[model samples]
Target: MFIISLTYKTSLENVERYIPGHNLFLQKYYDSGQFIASGRKEPRTGGIIIANAQSMNEAEQIISEDPFYIHQIAEYEITEFIPTKYNENFKIFIED
Candidate 1:
């Protein structure tokens, strides 16, 4: 699993301009089952994405495809983790 944190480097006006494109990017990954969940952070600073990429390389590649990354709208911080325990329904997103 990966916790993809995004911190805005630019103004909200700039971020809003790319949100539509960003939503499309997110939908593409969601359709591929790579993105588990994503949303804006409180105080509206940036956003977070819970992704199910198999490795750090894969995760980085995924991030590379984001409009935010391409436009340098935000800084990315990716943290990879092992899910020791999760809800039974969440097993579908977990890998052995």
Candidate 2:
């Protein structure tokens, strides 16, 4: 199943500050077949991340690992997702 994570940063500044750490985590996870994609929201709010997990509980646990979450830079509102449509060539969407 998929999980849609809606993250709201305490401030875009904080988001930026923690982005590098969080990004590395996302990259490692995605490469290992955990997170599919993760990036900042349009206008620079926080980020929207799509992840593949065995269960909602696992998804939540994964979200908890984000540096932003640990540093109090962002708060995540995560939910189960059914991604019926996806663009594999968009460069942002990865099955992993």
Choose the strongest candidate by TM-score. Answer: 1
- Residue-wise C-alpha lDDT for candidate 1, range 10-90, written one tens digit per residue: 999999999999999999999999999999999999999999998999999999989999999999999999989999999
Model 2 accuracy (lDDT, Cα) = 0.71
Off by over 4 Å in 2: 83-96
lDDT per residue (tens digit) for residues 1-96 in model 2: 565555664766656777679878798888977776676678776667777787889988887887877887777777776666766674444344
| TM-scores for every candidate against the unseen true structure | 0.96, 0.76
Q: In model 1, where do residues sit more than 4 Å from their true spots?
A: none
Q: For candidate 2, which ten residues in a row score worst on lDDT?
A: 87-96
**Best by lDDT, which number?**
1
Error of 1 at 92 (Å): 0.9
